[model samples]
Target: MQRSKVILNSPKIAIGSRADKYWSENGFLDYSKFIRPNLDLPKSLSYGSNPDLLRTKFGIAEIGFGNWVTNEDRFNYVNGLIISLYDLNKLMNIDYFLGLGLLSVSFGARGAGSALAHYESQTKIINVTRYHRGDESKLARFVATGGMGSFAHEYGHFLDYVGGEYVSPHPQVFALTGGRSVSRSRMPCNDRQRLRVITNDLLEKIIWKVPNKTPSAYYTRLAKFMMANGIESDYLIRRNELFARWFEAWVSLKLRSMNIQNKLLSQAKYSPLIYPTENEVREVDKIFQDFMKEFKSGYFIG
Candidate 1:
C-alpha cells in the first residue's frame, strides 16, 4: 500500500545500483523487449511518498502538480521523479537545490512538450504532458518517455537559474560534508564552474577535439550528427547545456542507469554526447575518483 519504501524494499529496479552492478543485472530497459506491460509496476511507484520529504541535507522544493490528471498518474510521475532526485542527491554531498524554495509541475500545460522546466515567480516548475498517445504512464516509461536525461537536463537549467541569482550560500545550507576532493584547491565554483572544468578538461580534452575517440568522442560525434541533420550545432552544444549534460552523464555513471544511456541515443536532442562509451565512462570514473581523492572539499556540485 505504501510506495515510499519501494526503492529501499523492492528489488525490481534499484535506482541506486552502481554502473557495474546495473549493467551486470541487466537493468537497462528496452520497450521492444517488453511485450507484456505490467500495469501494477507503476502503482508501486505511485502515492504515499514525497521526494522532498526524503532530503537529509538541506531542503528540496515540495512539488505541486497541475490538477488535470488522476492522483494515480500524479503519484506515478512523482515516484519516478524522486528516484532520480535521490540518485543525484546521494552524489551531491552538498545542498545543490538550495536556491529554489518551491517547485511546481504541470500535467496539462497547454501546448507543452513531454516535459520542460521554467520559472514563475520564485518557484521553479517542470511541465510534463499529463497523457500522451497510448500513454506509457507507468513509472519507467513515463520517466524515460521524454528521455532519461530530460529530468537531469531540465533540472540543470533550473540550477543555472538558481545559481545565477544566488551569489552566496543559503542560511539553511550547511557546509560541505566528507571533507574535500583533494585536487580542488580552486575556489568554490563561484561562476559555478564544477562541470565547466570537466568541459575543458575531461570532455574537451578527450571527446570534443579528438576525432572518432570512442567513449569520449562527444563533441566530434555531436558535430557530425548536427551537421548531417541540419540542426544548428549550437542547439545542444552550448555552455549551459554542457554543464547540465555533464550531470546527466554523471548520473548515468553514478546510478549505472543504462536506461539513461539508451535513452540518450533515443533522445537525440538531449546530449547522448555526455553519455560516454563504457570505456570512456570507465575512464571518467577513474579520473573523477582520482580527482576527488585530491579535492579538498567544497560544493563543486552542491
Candidate 2:
C-alpha cells in the first residue's frame, strides 16, 4: 500500500469528533482549539528551522492519562488506555499511539514505570509515561522546580522515535533493549517514510549541538553519585539529569558566540525552552570553563 502523503503545515480542525469528546472529557481546552477536520500534520518546510528531524506524516498527540490502582487490573486498564488513546478515525489500523502520561500499576510511587516506554503492538501504541500522581503540592513543586527538565528528556525519546538517536546510556537504558519488553515496532510505509524525513533532520541538528560524551559515560558518573549516597535503583536516574546538564553545557557554549546564541535562545519558548535556576546557570558556567580548557588542550573533541 502507498504511504499517506505528508501534509506541510498542520491544519486547523472543525469541531465534533472523537478528539472533541476526548478533549472535552480531559479539559484540554487550550489544545482542543487546534484540532482540525483532517489530520493536522505540521508541514515539513517549517521543519527546516528545526535542526533535528523534518516534519513528517506521523502526528504528535500528547494526552494525560493514568492506569488502574492494583496488579489485577493493571494489564486491563493499560489496554483500555491504549484503546481510549488510539486515533480510531485512521480507517483501518494504520495509525500508531505514543502515550505520554502517567501509570499507577503498582501501589508505590507514581512515576515507577516511567523509565520504560510501554508498547502494545495489538493497539499500535507506544506508551511513554514520566510523571506520577504525587500530592498536588508535590506535583506543583516538581513542575516549578524540575518538571521542564523531565518533559524535555522524555520528549527527546519521542523525537528519537521519529528519527533521533536514543542518546541515552546504552544497555543501561532498557527502553530499546532486545528484551521482550523492548523492541522496535514497524509503522506503515507512508508513516515511516514521512516521519523519518522530518525527525531525522531535526535530530541531526539536536545531536550535533551536543558534546561528544556518550550517555553511558555520563550515567556511569551518576551511578557513582548514587552509590556514594547509598541509593537503591541507583541504576535508575531521572531522565532530566541528562537534559539539565546538556542544556547547561549547550547554553554555555552558545554564550561564547553571542549573536548566534541569541538567535537560538529566542526559540527556547517553542522547543525544549528552559529557564535554569541561578545555581544551574552558575554550574553551567563552570562546565563551560572545563569545556574551554579541554578544547584549548586539544584533549576534548566533538
lDDT of each: 0.41, 0.28
**Residues 221-251, candidate 2, lDDT per residue (tens digit)?**
4556667767775223433233333543444
Candidate 2 matches the true fold with a TM-score of 0.28
Q: Any idea what lDDT model 2 has?
A: 0.28
Q: What is the lDDT of candidate 1?
A: 0.41
Write candidate 1's Cα lDDT for 1-302 as tens digits. 12233223333323334632553355433232121122122333332234433332224444445554444454445444544453444455344343234444444342243344333324465454443335554545544543333555555555544443432333432111101121212223334443333323543444444433333356667667778778853645554455455545555566544333223212334445445555655556654443332231432424
Off by over 4 Å in 1: 1-47, 51-58, 95-123, 135-149, 164-203, 210-216, 257-274, 286-302
**What local lDDT does model 1 show for residue 28?**
36
Separate clash counts for every candidate: 14, 17
Best by lDDT: 1
TM-score, cand. 1: 0.54
